[model samples]
Each structure stands twice: as C-alpha cells, then as structure tokens.
Target: MMTMPTISNQNGAFPLLRKTELRRLLTEKQLQQLEQFCRASSKRAGSTLFRQGDPADTFHLLADGMVELRARPPGRRVYRTVELIGPSCTFGDEALFGETTYLTSSRVLETARVLALTRPAFDRLAANHPDIALGVLRCAGNCLIKTIRRSAILTQAPADVGLRMLLEELAGGNGNGAPIPVRITHAQLAGVLHVSRETVSRMLGQLASEGTVEVGRGIIRISSH
Candidate 1:
C-alpha cells in the first residue's frame, strides 16, 4: 500500500524558498502563485518519501532537515546515494517534466518538513506561468550537470583521492582542520565513492592512524594540523 503524507499547516509562510535558486528564477508574483499549490507535511527520520519506479505524481520542496536520494541498480543488493537534498531545495522535477516514474527513491535522513505539489498542479502552474517552467528547467539542468560531474569523479579518481575530495567538500574546505558537520556511515560513503564498504573502512582507518582524521561513531573529524 502507498503511504500518505501527514499534512501540516504552512499557509504559504515559507520565506526560505525565496532565498534559493528558485527565487532567482521566479518573479515575486510567480513565487506567490507557486506557493499556492503547495501542501506542507512532516516526515520522520528513515521514512521513505517515494520509491524508485513509483509513479511520479508530486514535486517536493524541503522546508527543513535532510533527504537522501538512493538508486538501486538491478541485481544489486545495495543502493547508492545519488544526492542529498537539504532545506530550501526542491526535488522531483523529473515528474513535472513528464517522467512516468521516479528515477530514485527518497528517504528522510532526519525529521523533516516538506512542501509538495502534485504533478497536475505543477503542470497547470507551468502552463499558466512560463517563467516558473523555465526556472524549473534550469534547476533540473543544473542538477543533471552535478550528477554528471560526480560520475566523472568516481570513474576517474582513485578511491582515496575521491574520498578526500568528498570529505573536503563536506568539511567546506575548512583548512583540513574543522570537523565535517554531517555524520555519515561507511556504507553510505562507499556508495557515494562507488567503492566497497571494506575499502572505505580501510581508508578511514589509515587516515585516522596518520592523524589526518579522527573517526568516531557516526562522525569523522578532519585534522587541520
């Protein structure tokens, strides 16, 4: 059975979305109209928002917390996390553009609030407001570019270098001395790096031994020294 989202009252009071890429693309009027289509909901951690291959019927905007996009290739026991969606970002645009099914499964990584618009609603909005449609297209294009770049990195870089680059990104290039704020598992890191969990564990251990990083339960702190 398909799960229904738990609805909440937002009353179009989401100011954060106005600071995102969507705001850059949409005019004030368009933004207001777009919000009119939204219905807010709250999801608990570990809840699956939608599964891969499910019928694409809605688009979502993360109002708070995190969501992970994972894709399971056929005959594979594990799913790779393709992207992490954070607050103020939108997802599920593939559905708006006529995709029949979701390309990846979305699962909540933390307690989250989301604003959703059904495909039909999005289509109507797009039909009436060409600027909103254009903005969404640009956003989707940017996401595609990032995905392509990540694929290139995974294929071209050595596992350790790729892992380091990923850590640096998570750490926000804090001079290699600051802790990466996000906590992740070896399995998830393995998926992102296109490597095995054992490989990730071994590399992390080596880094820890070298004083390059400090590993704790669910955390890895990079050493700036």
Candidate 2:
C-alpha cells in the first residue's frame, strides 16, 4: 500500500485547491477537512502519474500545470490522448465512487504540482460529510457526461470535421478569430483525432494554404480573417 505524506500549510497547497471548482462545492470547514486528507507532490514533465489498470487508490487535483489522460486500447501499439487536464481540474474522481482500477493513464505534460487524497481518506470524508460528498459526486457525473458527449460527437464526424471541431474546442469556441491557447504537435493532435500523423499534417497544410489556419513548430493558430 502507498502511504500518504503528512500535509502542511507551509506548502500553501490548500489555497491552490481552494480556487478550483471543487472548492466551490465545499465549505471552508469542509475544505480544511479535505486538506487534512491530501498529500502534495511536484512532478516533472514526462512523468507518468498513473497507468491504466493500476489500482485506483488516489484521486488527484492539478494545482498547477498540465497533465494528459491517455489510453491504449487492447492490442493497440499507440496510446490515444483522451483529454488534456489543465490547472484547477481534478482527475481520478472515479476512485471516490468505488472504481477499482484506472481506465486511462495520466502523464504530466509540464512541471506540475498535484494534491492527492487516498481512497480511504476520501471514503471517510464522504461518510462524514454527506453534502460535500453529494456535491463532488454531481461534479464528477457532469464531467463524465460531457466527456461522453464529446467522444460520441467526435467519433461520428468525418475526420476533417472532427479536426475542425477539436480546434474550435481548444480555442474555446471563439470562432476562427482567436489563437489556440495551447501549443500542440501534429502527432499529439493525431492521437486525439484518431487519425494518422500524415493525415493530420496534410490536412493542416491544406488548411494553411486556404488561409483557415497557420501552423508552426508545435503550434497551430486559427486565422482571424
């Protein structure tokens, strides 16, 4: 069993988590109780946080930086990125509801500060605070529903349409007028879009020529005009 480290106020981890959506659902006293159950860690880019099939014993919250959730279908050679979790997002929430194993692996994409609560601690919290537990469950359920809808919509679309939709989503639906806030590579985009890297590159090139977008090293920006 993995042991949780003692939490302290010196690291200022509580204030960081307080700004996340999770905090909105929890009262100040509940938040303080939550802090008691969490342990903080700093991870470097490229570090694997957890792997699919691993025991889902902890739930994680990203206090800073980014992480990617990826999955390798059985017998598949390459992993597909299912989601890119930014700061203030929580992952592994399923563990709180009795999930035994992780469905996807998570990797840090940048230097990240993370706070995690063990399943035992979470169960205790849920047992003691029904309101907080209900709120967290609702939040997790909504996120799961959104992810399901996005996957269903994207998978049913033609590759080109899916690609465009993805780009728009990354741009926060600011139309084609705003630059995508995140830097991404063609291969990474391919993984998310479930297309070949060559296909992604060729399509991007076509979009560039048509003045729909501009692609550069590790970046793709939608044109305002």
Candidate 3:
C-alpha cells in the first residue's frame, strides 16, 4: 500500500490544546471523571474514524490533528467537505437531538488522536454532575448557533464570495503565513465551495486569468493581486 506524507508542526508533534472556555466547559465532575478514563487514540492519514449516518451516541474530543466532516451528496461520487475541525474540538453533539444517525462522516486528514465518550457514560456522570452537563449543553448550543450563521452566509453569498470567505478564514488561522499556503486538490476545493469539480476548475481558471489566484497541480494560492 502507498504511504502518505507526514507534516510536522514547528512547536511539537501536535498543536497545543490550550485551556479555553470550550475546554473549561467540559471540565465538570462528569467530564473530569470521563477524562480519567480517557484513552488517547490515533489514526493514520486518509483514515475514517466514523462514517455518516452511523450511530451518534458518543462525543469525540479531538485532542490532536485535523478532521474533515463530509457528506456524499446525492448522485455524486465525491464527498463534500461540510466542515474542517482542528485540535481541542468536540464533535457528534448532534446526537443530543435524539437523532440516532450522524449527519456527516468524520475523516482524518492527518494522523489524529481523539478521546471518545459515550452519551450513556456522560449521562451517568452528568446525573450527579449537573453543572458540567449544563456547561456541555451551552457549548453545544454555541456550536449550533455558529452552524446557523454559517448556513445563512452560504445561502446568501455568491459562489466566489463564499470561496473568498473560506480563503480569508484559512489565511487568518494561527501559524498560516501571509501568502496563505493552502495546498489542496481541485476536488477538495469543490467540496469546500459546495460546487461541482468542473465548476471549481472553471471558477479557479477565471480567478487565475484575472490574476486573483494561481493554481498548480493540486495546490491553489489566492494572490493579493
């Protein structure tokens, strides 16, 4: 089997997960105890830890690495990139809506380590640790609000506008340089832009012709010009 290339971080093996409000939100008695049983598990690049429509009773805390939340749109061979999650992130809270299935699959973009906790386990813990559960609920609520906002933006914005928004977001992320070195495939860009691969290529060609961007084999650079 072919092996994938490894990308190393400047600081350490993985990005540091700082103590943010998100982390603090999960620090209740239930989460504190769940933390004790926490086993950090890792996966290889291009690996999928969970698939869409799978059971969603557990919450996964991504301790390290990047994950892509994807969905296979009807009649499409491609899995669209719905969201990109980084370290110190939690996923699968959609299950709390009493839904038995997941809305999207979680795939590993790189080697990843995650802490998994089931809803039953969290519930038992939360029964005695109400404050932590409340905090967790609040965190989930915030995520839902953000999702709503993103949906509104996508629905109202033009394709180029949406793509530019994503570019700015990636460029502003920590550790990314001014040139915004984003190396991704055209197909990947299609997924991100919620367009067909052909559309992505055509739009990208237009951008390049306009001197607004440059595209190589699988990488694209949004230029300042």
Candidate 4:
C-alpha cells in the first residue's frame, strides 16, 4: 500500500509535508508572480537527508546550514563520505539531469531550512531562467570536479592522507587556522577511505595520542599544531 506523507505545522501557518510526490516542489508561476518561494517549512539538525544510491526524485534549495555529500565504497562496508556542500546549494539534482539515482548521501549538520523542488517544477524554471539554469550547470560541474578529486584521493593516498585532505577542505586552508568542526562518525570516515571502521578508530586514536587532532562525540577537530 502507498503510504501517505505526514505534515507538521510550526514556525508558520502552513504545514510541512512530504506529500505531492512527483510534483514540482517549487513553481515558476509562483516565481514569476514574485510570490515567496516555499517558506521554511521545517528544519533538520544532524539529519541524514538522503542515502547513497537512493532515488533522486526531488531537489532541494538550502536556505541555511550545511549539507555533507557522501558516497559508498565499492565493497560491502555501509559508510561513505565524499564531500560537504554549503548553504545556497542545490542537491539531489540527478533527477532533473538524467536517469541517474542520487550519487551521494546528504546529511544536514545543524538546523537547516530547505525548499524542495520536484523534477517538473525544476524543468519549468529551467526553461524560463536560462541564467539560473546555466548557474546550476556550473555548480554541477564543480560537484563533478570534487567527486573526481575524492576518487583520486582515495585511490592513491593513504588513510591518513585522505583524512588530511578532508580536513584541509573543511578547514578552508591555512594550516595555522582553527580546524572546522567535522560532524561525522568514524564509520563514515572509514567508508570514504574504503578501510575498516576499526582502522579509522585506530588511526584517530594515533592522531589524538600524537596531538594532531582532537576527537569528540559526533565531532572531530584537527589541530593547527
């Protein structure tokens, strides 16, 4: 039996819902009319929005907050960590582009405000907003570049190096600066490295022992020293 979507009301008069499946989450008609795009219906904190290999049936416009994109390894290990995408970003875009499913999993780091866009609605907007469409194309290109870089890193670099590269990206460079908060689990890290979870735990322990990084519950911090 098909399950009905649940709806909740909070922070606004309208209710949050997962219904309207296969419909455009946003409409060009609404945009052309200058009506507010869907209001912040709901917020998610430390939530997994989608999993790797899941069907890409919807797209999302992040109003605020961070989203991490992770990819599962080739083996049977269940974890993945490819990259982290920031606010004002569009994700779950494969549904609009091609037959491909969601290539990566997206997780929300904190309370996030997002607008959902179904495929048809996205298509209509793309038809009218050539500039916006091109912009999204560019973003997709950037996503591809990051994906390729991650693949190369894991294929050639050691686990520590892979972990370092992740830290560098998160820290936004400048080794002397404070390390960014990495909100992920060791199992996820292992998936990115295609290594065992135990290996990741051990490596992190070694780093902590050497004063290279600090570990916390649901957070990892790299040391500037």
Candidate 5:
C-alpha cells in the first residue's frame, strides 16, 4: 500500500523562483505561470510516496525532512535502501524525461513538506518554457551523477582508505588540515563500505590505537597528527 499527501495551497511567488538557477532560467511571465500552478503537500512519516513499478506521473522537490528510496529486484523479497533524500532535493526525476515506471520505492522517513509537479503540469510549462524545465533537469541529473561517482569512488576503494577519505570529506577541510569530529556508526560505515560490522570495528579500533582517530560514542574524530 502507498501513502498519499494532502494538497495545500501556496501563496506568493512559487518556491522554485527562490532557487537562483531557476530564477535565471525562467522569464518573468513563466515565473508567474509557475507561481499560479505550483502547490505544496505534507507527507507524514512512513508514507510511501511511490512504489516500485508504479507509473511515474510526478516528480517532487522536498522542502524539509527525509525520504528514503529503496529497491527490490523484479522477483526478490529483499529490499535495500538506495538513497536518502534530504531537504531541497528532487526525486522521481526520471519521469521528467519520460521514464514510464519507478525503479525504486520512495518512503518518507520523517514528516516532509513537498512541492510536487505532475507530468501534465510540466508539459504545460515546457510548452512556453522549455528551457525552464530542461534547466531543472540538467541540475538534477548533474547532482545525481556526481553523487553516484563520489559514492563509487569511496566504496569501491579498500576499506581503511575508504573510511579515512569519507571522514575527511565530512570534516570539510578547515584549510589548516584540522578535521572536525563526525558522528557516524559502525553499521552505517559497514553498509557504505560493503564490509562486515566486525571488519569496520576492527579497523576503527586499530586506527584508534595508532592515535590516528579518536572514536567516541557514535562519533569519530580525526587526529591533527
């Protein structure tokens, strides 16, 4: 069964106008058309926004909260989470390019405010604002490609190196080479690394003993040394 969100009216210029890229991509009249057309919806936690193999009639931009995308093989019972979408992100985007069905299922992990646009609405916009729709598609596709590439680079590497590199990335380079502590768990690390929990634990413990990383409750701090 799928969970559905209730429609809500929005006032003022549509939220998409607030995005700089969209603002630059759209004309004044097109922007007004969007404001008049777009609306908002609130999805409760545990809501199944869409299911695998469902028709892809709409794509959504998340305003806040988390949505998890999970995939199960055509005849398999096992489902694995493929992505976690945060606020200000887009999902169901293949529909924008004419993909007929969803490859994965989308479930709300927390209460989420979403701005959903159907294929018909997008078509209406594209009639007069083709560039506007393409611009959003380009941004979304680039972001998705970059994320996939980064994840591949991280997870496909050897375990110890992968963990170190991922932590450094989270630390966001303070310029002086000091890295802030990042809160994460062994299970999460294992999942991303495609390694066993014991492997992650042993590797982390070894690094901690070498004075290279400080491991605390659900957090790992990289030593300045």
Candidate 6:
C-alpha cells in the first residue's frame, strides 16, 4: 500500500480510455458522459491499486504501463498473479453492479497511468445517462466473455496446445495465416502456463522439431500453418 498520486481535471475529462474495448461499445456522447467521472492517477511500481475484499467502489482503466492482478488462496501466504493487465484494459467492474467486492488485489507492475470512475459518480451518470450506463455494461460483458474464453483455453487444452494458443495470442497473428515473431523468455511462458522452465523449454524443442516454431535466444517465431 504505497502512496499513490492522482490527477483529476476540473471538468473530469480523461480521454485515455479511447484505446480500450469500451470505445467500441460507447458512442461519442456516451463516452463523454462516462469521462465526466474519470480521475487519472500515476502510480509507481509496487503501488497497490486495490485489495481483495475491498469495497468495489471504483472501476479502473489502465491508460499506460502494466498492473498485476493477484490473489492469495484461503491458506496461502503469498499471492499468485492471475493476470498482467496492459494499457486500455478496464478492471474492477464489480463496482458497476451493486453490493460486490474485488476478488483479487491489483498492484502496479510498472509505472502506470490509471483512470478510475467511482461508484457514486457512476451512479449519478447511470441515473442521468442510461445510454452511457448500458454501453459501459456492454463493454464489461465483453470483457467477462474473454475471461471465460481464456480460462477455458488454459484449463482444457493440453500443455503444448495451450502454449501454441498463447503464442498466437501474444504474436497478434500476422492476418495472412502467419504469426509475427514475439520476444519472450521461457520463464515468462512457464509463469503463464503454471509450468516449470524445463517444461516450457522441452515443449518448445518439441514444437521446433515439428516445424511449428523456431526458438532462439529469447524469441519464438511460430509457423503460419
């Protein structure tokens, strides 16, 4: 719980969320309505944005840098990182629904710019601007869908399959049935897959022999087909 620095314009105008999935869900006027409640903050690494079980009174969007969302299990001493959120992603949408709390804590992984919309502010906006409210809900719904989809892939797919899917996602696909080379280490892949470094390296070697990927140093170039 380090100190946090925040900046809110007099008019409450923050346009940084334009890069998020929300931008597609909201019309220009609806987006303006939502922005009127925005408060921006610059947080250093190690800053705690919110904690598990905290009253979910604010929704957050990362305008820049990264944050780690983590949770401690009932008997665990250390928190496990569940996700690494990047720019334009919204989180803590539990605030948008009534009487809910955060399931995990968010910590700044890098110096970050965050935009927050408080519950009270959102309440007022919802009352006066239902269209905007609905738009925000739609965006949150889409996020939930992606989370469910990602969970399915991680839990249901085999290790090598899951790794391939993850690589495709990170590579962002080259659109012509090819994957752009991505720079990442075996340790990073192991952390995400909840496997060991040796396991990731072995899988990569297998994939290389199969002509599925070429791994060198710290990068992986996945085959198109």
Per-residue lDDT tens digits of candidate 2, residues 1-225?
322232232575577668666777878877776677677777777778788888998888878777788898999987888786766667887588778999888887667788887888777877887677676666566666766787787778998898888776665455555655446678877887778899999989988888778899876887644
Instruction: State model 5's lDDT.
Output: 0.70
lDDT of 6 at 11: 28
Q: Tens digit of lDDT per residue, candidate 5, span 15-124?
A: 64454234555677666667554566777777888898899988777766667777886787976656656566678886787899988889886677777778888888
Residue ranges of candidate 4 with Cα displaced over 4 Å: 1-42, 51-55, 61-64, 68-90, 100-105, 113-116, 173-179
Better of 1 and 4 by lDDT: 1
Question: Over the stretch 102-140, how does candidate 4's per-residue lDDT look in tens digits?
Answer: 887787765666666666655765777655455445655
The backbone clash count of each candidate, in order, is: 2, 0, 0, 1, 0, 0
**Which residue pairs collide in model 3, if any?**
none
- Per residue, candidate 6 scores C-alpha lDDT tens digits across 1-225 of 324554333323446667677778887666776777777667777778889888888988777776767777898887666665656677887788775788878877667778788998888878988888787778777777776788677758888888888877665555566645665668767766777789999999998998888898866888876
lDDT of residue 191 for candidate 2: 80
Off by over 4 Å in 2: 1-10, 171-181, 210-214, 221-225
Over the stretch 5-108, how does candidate 1's per-residue lDDT look in tens digits? 65455445346457456777778777777777667677877778898889999888777777788999899977788776766666776677788999988988
Whole-structure CA lDDT of model 1: 0.75
lDDT score for residue 102 of model 1: 92
State candidate 1's TM-score. 0.82
Clashing pairs in 5: none
Q: How accurate is candidate 3 locally (lDDT)?
A: 0.63
Q: What lDDT score belongs to each candidate, Candidate 1 first? A: 0.75, 0.75, 0.63, 0.61, 0.70, 0.75
Error of 6 at 225 (Å): 14
